[model samples]
Target: MDINRVSARNVHQAHYELIVIGSGFGSTFFLDEALKHITGRALVIEWGDYQPWAWQVEAQSNSPIAPESTYKNSGNKPWNTTIALGGGTNCWYAQTPRLHPNDFKTRALYGVGHDWPLGYDDLEPYYCRAEQIMSISGDPDIGKVLPRSQPYPQPPHKGTSVDALMKAAMPDHHFICPTARPRMATANRSACCANARCSQCPVNAKFTAENGFPSLFSHPKVDVCLKSEVRTLEYSGNQISGATIASEGGEYKVFGDVFVLGANAIQSPAILLRSDIDYGQTGRGLHEQVGANVEVFLEGLKSLDGSTITTGYNYYFADGDFRRNRASCLVSFENRWWPFGLRKERGRWDEMLSLSVVVEDLPNPDNRVTIDPQSGQAVVDYRGESSYAKAGIEHVFDNLDKLLAPLPVESINSRIWRPTESHVQGTLRMGIKDDGSVIDQNMLHHRMRNLVVVGTSSFPSCSPAAPSLTAAALSIRAAELLYS
Candidate 1:
């Protein structure tokens, strides 16, 4: 079955059974799962064009942090994201960790944030399914920290010498970080070459939306339209009727029985605000991870060499009584040595090691995304109270020497890499109420019966782990509910 690629001008249908916006994990996962249960016509509207693997690798190699040319960053804080077909997965580091069970009930356990409408157990099976699709690799023992119904799809990637040394030095604190890089050549992706460049795997070794679900595009029931920027949703009496889209050629409307907003945490809320929805919670509860990186020079041990980007992590302090007052911190040992730029100066770039600490940020209603009534652009007024995050950072700094005591460290320097909004979350929070939340457990709008929103935007709170895996699981779960 060939995927019918149609231009926005060629969509002659009066209405589709389902219309999904965005081509990221949220949209792709939902569509992939829905296709298993339903056979009706589905239309996917993507704002960006299809980016081939080789083209993405070459483009990323030239500009590491370059923003997508088609996206506009009108907000006070720039959202570092790609607008291409696979979305951020095109440039993601591929770190895939499940949110701890405690993450779902933070408000009940730690008294910091709101509890999710659902819990970790409800999504564990879906997490396994998502991991299988992404060809995730990790130590099965990671389930000790976060419970899992099944082991990862692949064995853990071989760690670098630096990772082994770190584990030996801090045996009680170190563990392998779960990742979405294929360990062996699979049908859709190649085995990782240990290039330390997982962000843009030159050989298409990293799992992404495009590689994971090639059949989704070509399925007979699916129709994909590229470069169709969705502007606003049309609704009547609490039911979404259609969406107004703008393309290079002109503007038009596409009707659908069910509408899904998967344009990510920022753009999704922006679209809702533009539609003049009265839902007070549409653009509230915005937050993201607060992160810092420390550079350490090992006196004798060799670092870098040839290895995966991130192999080991320190999660001993990820959770505990510390959650009562401050956020938990997850430390990752980064194997990418090129970022240090020490090769030219010392010629001993292998001696440099970078440890990144990420502190989870609680939701703050004041820190949110709003549309500029005048400019008609999304404006994020993010003033995240960092007291909890700062406490977590200070704890990591205080215990840094003790954790790396076995290593002969020449010097240690730390810098706070301010939040880049790369992990944008919690804009369209889910809850049991309509007054304070925009979506429900099924990701359906509290008031709009036929509308569903997927992705991190519906997250009530963030966990120490990366949100992509959790987002994928949630999207799949939402699809199942909608299909039923």
Candidate 2:
């Protein structure tokens, strides 16, 4: 199969009903809904070539093109993403958890960051739709914390001994991790083997754009152009007129009645900035939780028996009165066994557990993405992580031992700081007005009515959870609200 296929056709360039800028969760999920109802032509512009799952596995990389070349930055913080046809879907671990209800109302409930213009209920139905499309495996009991409309398409994954202990102790807060990794073998993929190289799943068990939404791209109404990077958007009055695209052949334009920017937090805003369409805090409020890794050494207990890598979560620390003062945290119990996962002692080889403390940070307008004048690529100035998140990590490091007091006695290792969460967000923030936001609650550009900006770029808050599910849900809702 040709890995780098580009359709030379003008895309019927004269007119397209919709022109989407990325093939990530935001674009694909939106097309999933739009194709079902809208009868017009849709064009997807992907910056990277379509490398199949088999090719990706054989290559041992998501893309032949490196992610670093897509942007220019001098900051020490690493920006992680796959710049390919499926975007981050090719490399993400697929830990699909919906944001807690309070995550929508940070200002109202926790008296901190701005609340989301839309709430959990607004996206709840679309969340179910996205989860169904991805065949998400999750514990239904998680509905206790975040309300659900339907049962998960797949059953909950098995838990490790550590997960079992935590759940037995805190039934209300601890639950099987909601994931896009299949629990059982499905027609499209096999069950997860738990090797933990989830970035590039060796067994092809995780939900990727290749397996999960294959039909969405191939739909008769949709047309895709691979290795075409959109540099800027052109608009007049209050509508998006066209986009300047850089492709293998040369630079060109693609015209559409509606445009959706799904090129992630950094690139999306950079595209807008390059177009000279800066407004509504175009490249501001960039934020994401940079959390800590907590490795627990157990005495007699053994772990790593789960069906998936991450088995369960302790949400007790994820939300509480402490959120008012410190960032909220979602603690994930990693059910992974490896050479590094083992205890050094011969007798206690399996007596170890790994936990990831993911914290929620308030948006800092100072941390943002801008277009570098020299290269015209994304320049992410993102050093402004909140003290709220830092305090949240400290809280976990200080009290995790006590929280695990019910379990076997052992050493709780020092918290190791992470360089990046791999989730970039809030660059093109959404709000009720156009002054301090790019898009509205419905994902529509506040001033450019026909232009919709989807994905984490429109996120108002940086929740600790992975952004894929919420991104998918928002896209689906955007299509539904616009077309239906």
Candidate 3:
């Protein structure tokens, strides 16, 4: 937690078998893999720190963007993204849901983006590995999708008081199904205690890089240097020789035989562009599966009272909309306040269970993440219609109303203009043609042989399910291709 001491002054002397940028789920997962598999010198360059200054903490306390950037809201405006040791995974709401099988081939069905080179079968093993790594727990059969190879490593957390109330009101509605079990830091190394202040898990049940990857910091094969911002790539010809890192004290060049960019969709592509390493469409064709919480307020009920769970009912999987049966999922207590613990301390348990319907958006080029020319900073240009998004909202609301006929539910509101996307994909899209993609199926850069690009950003289509598990799945594949 010593943020001020880990300076970027020793980049020139640093050596690694692999150099990873950013500290998000994608980057952290890959680094975890390298630590186990590679066995040589590996270093992760994280832009942020675990403990921000008092001012930084105050600035990032209430952001809708929540886990990603400490300084920004979940909107079109630019904000200071976090540079913590754990990255955004530190503050993320660990709700891991698998992508539907059809999500892998959206192009064949809807002609939107290119189909993923791989599919569910290809990722299933890694998905299981990732779930185990994160210590996921859930019911075996909560939905139509998610065929697990093994049982969850842990048991489901108990729901809160508000969750219990919702279950009582809508006894038949599968508003809250078996949600994903969160991975957190714990002394027992088993499951989380699932306490009220679980977000700040005294025992780490939530899977965070802060707690997960830090265990590897002592390994000689792994070196995690925080506060190290990669300025540019040091290349010999087209291959990356090393990278220039700028920190609080000074800057130096670090070299690696192989380089992997796992800086999420925006920062990853931005680093490539800044390195003057263009593989055709460097940052175009970005696709983020935008999400909005369509909340329905039920009259005359206390807040839902149930144990915390990541299980959700995928009504969309059966709905025949946009060529896919699934249109959205029901998150019965997503915005519900009691389980979050803060509202409970304030004695606000009289609230009703707020249902959140999550829907997937049609991919369009108009919605993208790009580097702003004037400010030279990353900017998100989201221009999809809120009306189309509401269609899914309406769809979910109608079903909930029918199921709980006399539950006195009224007034549905869809409020996610610029969605908080943990599943960011597409920017350096993968495809057959070099003119359109930055990397090929093997995750090799179209232009550079030694350089590899992994993570959700390479996915041609943004899948409906969350991308963290899938991204880890892809990283498992990428490591093989890189080391082979």
Task: List lDDT for all candidates, in order.
Answer: 0.80, 0.84, 0.58
Q: Rank the candidates by lDDT, best first.
A: 2, 1, 3
User: Can you write out model 1's per-residue Cα lDDT over 40-117, one digit (the tens) per residue?
Assistant: 789999887787777767776422334533334444555666676767777777899888888998888888888999
Error of 2 at 464 (Å): 1.2
- 1-484 per-residue lDDT for model 3 (tens digits): 2222334565467777888777676676766666666867777787765552233335544122333342112365332233466555655556766777776676676554468767778787887788777777664554335567777666655554444544555444333443233533354243544443433444445666545555655566666677667767877776888888877768787888888887767777767766777666776665554454444455555443444534334433332345443344434344344322322323434444444446565545555655644533455565543354456555655666564444455444344333454455677777676547778777777777777787777877655456666777677667755665
- The candidate maximizing lDDT is 2
| lDDT value for model 3 | 0.58
Off by over 4 Å in 2: 1-9, 337-340
- Clashes (backbone N, CA, C under 3 Å), per candidate, total 1, 0, 41
Q: Which regions in candidate 3 have their CA more than 4 angstroms from the true location?
A: 1-7, 52-81, 158-203, 236-238, 294-303, 309-311, 317-321, 324-332, 338-351, 369-376, 379-390, 397-423
What TM-score goes with each of the models? 0.93, 0.96, 0.79
> How many angstroms is residue 75 displaced in model 3 relative to the true structure, after the best TM-score fit?
7.9
Q: What TM-score should be assigned to candidate 3?
A: 0.79
Candidate number that wins on TM-score, 1 or 2: 2
Clashing pairs in 1: 3-218
